[model samples]
Each structure stands twice: as C-alpha cells, then as structure tokens.
Target: MARHIYVHNPFCARKCPYCDFYSVTDNFLCEEFYKAAIKETELIGSVITEDAGTNPLTDPDGKDTVYFGGGTPTVPDSRYICELLGAVRKAFNIASDAEITIEANPSSVTPEKLTEYRQAGFNRISLGVQSLDDEVLKTLGRLHDSKGAIEALKKISEAGFTNISSDLITGVPGETLDGIKRDIGTFKELGVKHISTYSLSIEEGTEFYRRYSGNIEDLVSPELERSMYHGTREYLQKLGYETYEISNSALPGYKSIHNSSYWNSCEYFAIGAGAHGFLNDLRYGHRDDVRAYIEEMNTVTYDTYKAFLEGNESFLKSLYVEERLTREDKMREVPFLRLRTTDGILLDEFKKVFGVEFEDVFADAVKTNLEKGLLERKERTLRLTRSGLDLANIVIEDFL
Candidate 1:
C-alpha cells in the first residue's frame, strides 16, 4: 500500500491579506500549542495502524511520502518540526527515497535552520516567494521583499538542497506583465528546480476579498491576467521548465511527488491542527482550534473517526465556503487536472475509476469545446489547446 502523510503548521509570523488558511499570528499561543498537537498526531497514527493490523513502528515496503504544509511549516521552532518528522518516521513505513517536503516563508527561515532541516530527512523545500518585485510583494502584504527571497534561495542552495521550489502569484493588484516576466527571468537565473505560479483569486473572508469585494476596479483586469499567464508560461517553457500541472512547472525529474498524490486521488494520512487525510476513499480533517485538537485526541473514540469521514464536506464548505464541488464535479475536474500533465489521463483508467467512458460522460460538452477549437482529443487522450489553457476556467466550467 502507498501511504502518504501531511503535517500542518498553523503558525505564521504574519498573515498575508490574500491567505485564508488556518493560521494564528500570536507567537505566545503558537509556542504553547504546537508541541502538544504534534504528540497527539503521533498517537493517532499509532492507534490507526494498530486497528488496521499493521505495525505502525516499522517500515514494510519503505514507500511513504511525508509533507509539511501549512501557514508556514518553517515558522515553528525548527527543532519542534524536526521532532515531528522523527516521530513520523518512528510511526510509519517510510521509503528510503520518500519525498519529504516542507513549506517555508522566505522571511521565516534561516541558513542554520535550513541546514538543520536538511539533516532532519527533509529533502525538499518550497519557498513562498509570491513575487520577485518588492512593490508587488508589498501590495500582497508579503513580509519578504525581493532581496530577502533571493537570500532565502541562496541559503537553500548552499545548504545542498537541490529539490527546491518557489511559489509565485500572478495577476496581483498593482502588478504588470513586464513585472511578471522579470520575476520568471529571476527564477530561471536562481536555478530553482520547480515553480508553482497561481493566479490571485480574491477568496471570500480573506482580507483581500473584503477590501476588494465591492471595488472591482482595484483588481487586475481579466485581459491583463490572461496576458500575464500566457507570457509567463511561454517564458518558463523557454527556460526548459515543463508545465506539469496547471500552476506548477518543474525541471526534468523534479516534480513534487506529495502534491501529485492529491491530484491522482491517492491515499494519505494527515496530522496537526486543521490537517486533513484521505484513506479508503474516506477523508477526515482535524479541528482548526489548536486547543481543541490537542484535547480531542485523548478523548477521541472510533465513532469520531466515522463522523469525521462523513462530515468532512460540511467542514470543508465552512472553511472554503464559496467553492463547493459536487459529484458531477468530475465532468470538469477530470480533464482540468489530467491536462496539467504531458501524459493525460488514460481512458481505461478513467473507466475503472468512474465506471463510465470518458468520451460518453462529456460527449456534448466535448463536442462544443472542440468546435470552438478549445480542446484536442488525440491518441485516446484529451487535452486543452494553447487557447484553451489561457481560458482554462471558462473551458473547465462548461461541463459544470
């Protein structure tokens, strides 16, 4: 069995205006609550493994992917995060080549801490450097400027971390097409292995959403956003980066294994406050409240696990209230996610998973999209055209 694990760090030095992830900025609360949460997660994993007739304390096949994702995994005491990784190793079957990834904010990491992370079996680091322009960084309320981001990149490189990735946001307020191109050029110069460029969507309940909800004029225009995305994609491709996913580009053989697990609908275990896990087609998310999560573990019963799997949708809706997906959601999701890769989804695999022919499922919608020259069906695989990629959301929503 392929097992994956995720550790959530709900602590951050500060929250960006566009971020809606579960995080707390109060240092005192974070320092007090994170350790206990980590311990509880270890215990939960132990119990689950015992119940499933598997040994939690030993690696059988050595095939595991552990990911540290959050508001900022590196924001917590480096030692504490290291201990959590140690515990995961003790409690799960981890592969020798397991992909262990940790997410870091450029402002929150140090050269020494990064070196320590490397020693702690963390082979991958993802820096949240949303933009290379100081002005754009400020507009996004990011704590680190371009200089800081470059320094962080240099530190990771010097520490012998070759599998480093950076996050970039396009279409942010006050950003220009030239500025985005400059960011891409800088990334290429830095010799980073992977890049995940996301469009800035004003999520509801976020500070950006509240500030710009009624004022549409303050946001990046649709045409400009498309132009920025197109230019960025072309520029990155020229640098020998493959567009492996919608927002992710990677150097050859450096794609993120842990993130790919989610898109492939593979099983994984989650630990820490607000962390989520999927197993046996059932999903569960931990409580967001740090105190509640720590306490509930001691008292949590088997029924709690059942309730979690069944009730996850409601919790997800409350957290990401605006973008709720449905069962028929696969109509769009299947192609959208598959097209992100060079090897699009196999028709036989889709039939096995969904019990339907891929073409038959979206026959009408596919016909319309092809007529408009937005999609291509070749060699038993379906993919988006260059024009379709620019208007991805529009093409995707047709099946919805």
Candidate 2:
C-alpha cells in the first residue's frame, strides 16, 4: 500500500566491472525470474487488499510512482517486461498521473522495445549512458560506445519518450571537463530532461575496487573530482537545469518523482532479488541470489505477504532480512534524508511526524552549522548551503 514501488530487475546482458548491484548475466533464468516476480506482486496486492482499512501499512490513495530499476531492465525480452508491468497494474490502483519508469542500457534497448514500453505505460526512461567518451566507456566496462548511446537516446526520443534521463559518471579515466560538456550538450540536443551525475567510487567488491585498492587516487584524484563536481553544477544551472538533489538535475518540471520520494524519506515497497524496502518502521531486503529469490516466490504460500507485514521471521528466513527500527531511529534519519534535497526539510511536516519542533531536537547542530555558514534557511525550511554540500559528510555527521 506504499505510495511508491521499486522493482529491481536482476537480469543483465553483461555485468559492468564497476557495478556492484545484485544482477546476473545468466539469460536462461530471465523468464522464470519475471514469472516469479509477477506471482509475488499479486500476492502482495491481495494481502494489502485483504487488510484494506485495518492495516497501518495501507495507503488507500494508491501508488503514484513505480520505478523499474536494475541491472539493465531492458536486458530481458520486452514481453517479460511488459507482462510484469501489467501484473503491477493489476496488483494496485495506479494513480492517473503516476510516473512509471524503466532503467535501460544502450546496448540492449531497441526501437521495438521502446514502442512496447511506451504502450505499456512506462512514461520515463533512464538510460545508463555511463560516459560519452569511448575510451572512458571501455574503461567502465559498459557495452555501448558513445555513438551507440547517442543512437539509443535518439531512438527513445523518437519513440515518443519526452521524460528521458541519462546517467553519467564523472571522474572516470580518460574523461575531461570538455568531454562532459559535450555530452551534456548532446543530451540537451536530444531532449534529455533529467541527468544523474555520479562520481566514480571504488566500492568494495567491484572490479575497480580490486584494481585500485591501494592506489585509489590513480582512479580519480580528490581535487579533480571537486573541480568536476562544481563545474558540472555551474554548467547545468546555466543551462536551465535545476539541481534538485546533490547528484541529480532536471529541467523545469521534469524532476524524477520516484527518486525524489526517497530523498523525502517516503516508505515504499521493493520487489525482486536484492530489492530493499522500508515500511511501517522496518527496513527489509531480499538476498542477492536471483535463483533463490525465484524459487522462494514461485513456491511462496498465500500467507507470505501477511507474514511479511507481521514480521514473521520464520516465514521469510530463507531469503529475507528485516531490520527493526525504533521511533527515534526513524526520526533521526528523516532530517538527514530530507537535507539531501535542494528544497530541504519542511519544518511543519517534521513536527507533525515526530511531534517535536525541529529546533527542539537539534538546535545545537543547526546553530553550529548555521554559524559556520554551512547551513542556510529559506522561510520555513533549512538546507545545506553550497559549502555544506561540499563538506556534506561533516555536516551530516552532526545530525547522525
């Protein structure tokens, strides 16, 4: 009954070396995985419907955002994707202006697939462009080159997708500021309204991590990263793109509703292998094993959803982990989460949720940061200034 839903597609045509997301390149498991996902969605809907008014988890207003993210959701056949989307619709009352999105890779997306997705009610398409420099793309282990990515963007736009997003990784090897400018220029030309920028980090368990474990600076120096970060912000703002989050920008009314919901600390239901969700004061996630997820959902009992709601550990012991949190934990987390956005925290909403004024709880922290010029206030909201965003870890730690 959550207002937002996140579906993690675990199939990928090929795994990127820098990606640590739970996904498999085994094409054979694709069909079974999606089928199990459909079955699971139906189970969730039925359980939510049964408990309708009585359950605290219920959100009778219906879902306004459904995000299909993953290891390249377009890797599988379009039929499976479409069928799964249909199952989601059948399971919930999607709002009339719902924003349904799909994450796609350039190498796997096709014109026909785009058409089908458009017809299937996927209003948004997020492309994994990674980098527009061919050498950088190769270094990142992405399957598509700059040319292929551009062509794919054109195809998505031609297929009538106006709400297009492109993901870019800054600080990548062989990337220059001029190259990024060219890429952004290309995106502007091709009608890309949203841009998600990420600084390449060598997370543990990734190929980049192994390759640059000791010499992380060789991958991307801190100074270079800072230059790119600020430069990207300035250029994007100049081009009329609003920097909504620390790493996301959108033109006018094109900001991502689904992603923004996360920044606001909204609870959502997460589906599929390795998907994580937060609801009713509990954070839960499925194991990263796709095969295990498929088997569990396919053989799941009708009481599975109810058990999940009740926190019956025995019912989900094999493939799920539920983290129980206290009221204080949720309260302390909301401000930090909301501060990630440009709009910052709404003081009245904060008080309504926690029954305490924002200043009463953390007046010292706010006063400290404000005195240091790392925080700013606009009428009824408080947010990080440009300096605070640069030193975010320092500012955010005080909240924690």
The candidate that wins on TM-score is 2
TM-scores for every candidate against the unseen true structure: 0.86, 0.95
Query: How much is the lDDT of residue 24 in candidate 1?
Result: 80
Predicted model with the maximum lDDT: 2
Per-residue lDDT for 260 in model 2? 75
Q: Candidate 1 local accuracy as lDDT? A: 0.76
**Root-mean-square deviation of Cα positions for candidate 2 versus the true structure, in angstroms:** 2.5
How many steric overlaps does candidate 2 have? 0
Task: List the global CA lDDT of all models.
Answer: 0.76, 0.84
Where in model 1 is the C-alpha error above 4 Å?
48-63, 301-333, 339-342, 352-356
Query: In model 1, what are the clashing residue pairs, if there are any?
Result: 62-95
Distance (Å) between predicted and true CA of 128, model 1?
0.7
At residue 61, candidate 1 shows an lDDT of: 36
